[model samples]
Target: MSDKIGAAEDPLPLRWLDHVATAMNVTGSSLILALMVLIGLDVAGRNLLGAPLPGVPEMVSLSIVAIVFLQSPQTLRAGRMPRSTALLDMLTKRSPRLAAAIEDVWDMIGIGVLATVAWATWPRLVRDWERGTFIGAIGDFTAPTWPVKATIVAGSVVLVLQFLARIWRRHRIPDGKAQ
Candidate 1:
């Protein structure tokens, strides 16, 4: 039997996770594009028609939060998150084993802190939803604030999980060689 399986033979859980991540990425990209287009139109309308788009700021803020949360896991998966590599590079050159150990420790601490913050913020998000807090803006454009808040909590949790995965994968490789 071959080690590789056909598409039909793939596990549902893995497929589902892939689908979810793909959907999140696409949705986040669409939201970002829409936000950009909307802002452009808003600015044009303001300059041309002398009237700004009502609640543009509120919409932009919410869209930005959604984009960040939805895109975070995808970014983490792609290893695109910003990092200061000067220290890590120096340490790795000196001692790869020590650098790996330090990285694992750092990831563990990050996971713990992010998980704790997510846990703490979840209830507050729920409470905000229950209270039906609205964005303060002129006119009747009321945006629900809980969803944005919850996104922050969810994104942090996902980032923590991603870091954990990275740490586990790093530990699995002998000699810390690039795969």
Candidate 2:
């Protein structure tokens, strides 16, 4: 584990999480591209032949949802989520220790919120699966939504773990240096 951590500036677990996030983002991008191409082809076929593509809207909608959920973890890992840094920056300038403590507390609260939301929504996801909900023009195009919901929950879990890792690394660092 130490060797793995030493191989990268980040801890091993965090690095692995980052890798997963990156992969997911790439996959999501690919899906988006495919969706665009599909839509373009469908439009061209309809305009040229006067025959509309069946279930194109439905497929695109599902693909968009998947892309959003799948890319969430990568966004979080990149620290791109919006946050209020006014108070944090002020505290950091005044007292480094207090700033660190506040940061840890903020991370904890974020983790708790994300975990609780994921936990609460999990049952609904299962119920949706059990009920066999389908979204499309025809019922035959049924694709289970549970997998996308599960991806969201999994992304939150990964974010929580990443925050915890950040807290741990912060403790390892001295007063004014990187860990």
Candidate 3:
């Protein structure tokens, strides 16, 4: 028990990444709560006061993307990302090593996909930040677009790291136990 606890307590980079991903997940949950509150208020105002909340539409649109990005890293880390696991499950019963290898390759592909997304997003993030780009009308409820862009980029990078960590962990364990 002590050994297991100590092993878990070790300050490894992958553990640090897990901590970061969990923190981001919590932030995403908080954002979701905030959005719910905002939406509820908007509905109440619209029904009772005959006036809806300003910028609610824009905020929802932007926040939807940010929330997905914010929560994705932890989702992947937790093995909760949606996928067809039927083949892997069948293969794992026959050959754990082969299944582990396939899983690692999948993680590699995930890293590549996320890296490409981050690469594409970086220039846009910079452009938005530099130009002070916003999503709302002038002299009204306006929010900077760069924050959402930055969140996307950051989330992609962290997800890539999580993928790498998964591969690393797979290799560290014996083949039969990898599943």
Candidate 4:
């Protein structure tokens, strides 16, 4: 709903994908809030009770990566992805078609990069799942790494899909749908 581009302009499938991305973004934001609370509690515990949360540091490390991946697609779809727009801005004034073409190319490159990241993460995810890989001490708090790896792969795929959607949106035919 925070998207700069209106949802009405998106095709049904793209709209569905946007919904998915928005849910993921919400989940990421919730995770951030949880982390903040956990850190605050840990600090309070340390200062007041002289007992800190055991897995706070490890949880924070894992959550940071999860947060970034979880929220990326929505960030891009909202037109909040950080980039210099000097060239595109100038190009748009001169030729809108050329600007769209250049944006499509840029999106294509984004697809490649995210796809590559997902492809590379797939094996690690499998390995972690199969081996039950975990972080933290043996007798203390421990968390499976597979979930985080899975998040990375899933997020990357969604991000690639978002990039493809961007390209498709740019190249839609006169019928108001992608070819």
**Which residue ranges in model 1 land beyond 4 Å of their true spot?**
1-22, 173-179
The residue ranges of model 3 lying beyond 4 angstroms of the native Cα positions read 1-11, 174-179
Best by TM-score: 4
Quality of model 2 by C-alpha lDDT = 0.72
lDDT per residue, candidate 3, 1-179, as tens digits? 01111135334887788889999999999999999999999999999999998899999999999999999998887778899989988988898889888887898899999999999999999999999999988876899999999999999999998888777665654435543
Clashing residue pairs in candidate 1 are none
lDDT of 4 at 176: 50
lDDT sort, best first = 4, 3, 2, 1
CA shift at 164, candidate 2, in angstroms?
1.9
Q: Between prediction 1 and prediction 4, which has the larger TM-score?
A: 4
Compare candidates 2 and 3 on TM-score and give the better one. Answer: 3
Superposition error at 115 for model 4 (Å): 0.4
CA deviation > 4 Å runs, candidate 2: 1-9, 84-87, 174-179
How do the predictions measure up, each by TM-score? 0.78, 0.76, 0.91, 0.92
| Best-to-worst ranking by TM-score | 4, 3, 1, 2
- The lDDT per prediction is 0.72, 0.72, 0.85, 0.87
Candidate 2 RMSD to the correct structure: 4.5
lDDT of candidate 4?
Answer: 0.87
Report the C-alpha lDDT of model 4 over 1-179, residue by residue, as the tens digit: 12244357677899899999999999999999999999999999999999998899999999999999999999998889999999988988898788888888888899999999999999999999999999999887899999889889989999998888777665666455543
- Compared with the true structure, what per-residue lDDT tens digits does model 1 show for residues 1-179? 11111133335643444455557778889988888998999999999999887888999878787788788766765566677868877988898878888778877887898788788889879989999987865475778889888877877767676676666556543455553
Residue 175 deviation, candidate 3, in Å? Answer: 14
Off by over 4 Å in 4: 1-6, 174-179
Top lDDT: which candidate number?
4
